[model samples]
Target: MEILLNLKNRICSLGIPLHAAFEDIGTDKTVELWSEIFLNCGQIMKEQRLDAGSAWKKVISENRGLLPLEQADWDSINDFGELLGKSDRLNQESVLDMARESIALLEKKAEEAMKTKGKLYRNLGALCGAAVVIVLI
Candidate 1:
């Protein structure tokens, strides 16, 4: 999300090209897999002169399983890819912002679910241990 936001700011404010922005962001070490994906997409965009949408879709499809993104997150990314290079810069920035918001919402929901389910599972484990102890006694 931060990466996408940064890309949006660079593209919108700095007027850097999409591929150039990706290549620059790809240098980050903490996100090696995403960095590789960004590099591949950047190369495709530069070498093949493909649109941002096409390059992004190609790279994402090839590396879908390795992305560590949920289906909703992938859907947001796909929507962003579909919008990229197909519209004006303002529109692209708006699309990125929307994707960021949607992904944030999904993240919040997932965290809440984890908290609830984690507590339930912990309680169940404790109950099962108590049952086993009672049986032994």
Candidate 2:
């Protein structure tokens, strides 16, 4: 549950850099902007002791139920990363759309998580704890 909430928070915060990077692309070479985005993101991930690509893979892989806030959301993020990680030429405008789409997705998921998911997790956790106590007794 904590991990889920943290993931949601992390995703939401990640959007700030993405948005800024998208805007930066308008004034700079698309390729250079993308390199900066990946570098900045990679550095941030490093601070958390996570590799650029492995962070997403590790978090999603390690806890399935914990962060299944939305499979589509995860897929979109993964796709975005893959797109950026590639050598293919990506249009600045199209990249902006992708970043915007991802931002919106994260925001929606964050709102939904706060509204209900957190409570559900708390309740379920409590139930599990009670079950463990009862079993011991």
Please report the candidate that would top TM-score against the real structure.
1
TM-score of each: 0.83, 0.33
Q: Kindly list the per-residue Cα lDDT of model 1 for residues 32-96, writing each as its tens digit.
A: 88889888888899999998888988999899998667787787676556666567788878887
User: Candidate 2 — which residues are off by over 4 angstroms?
Assistant: 1-37, 40-71, 82-90, 118-137
Best by lDDT: 1
lDDT of each: 0.83, 0.49
RMSD to the true structure for each prediction, in A, is: 2.1, 12.0
Considering only N, C-alpha and C atoms within 3 Å, which residue pairs clash in candidate 2?
none
Cα displacement (angstroms), candidate 2, residue 7, comes to 22
lDDT of 1 at 124: 100
Worst 10 residues of 1 by lDDT: 78-87
> Model 1: which residue pairs collide?
none
At residue 51, give the lDDT of candidate 1: 86
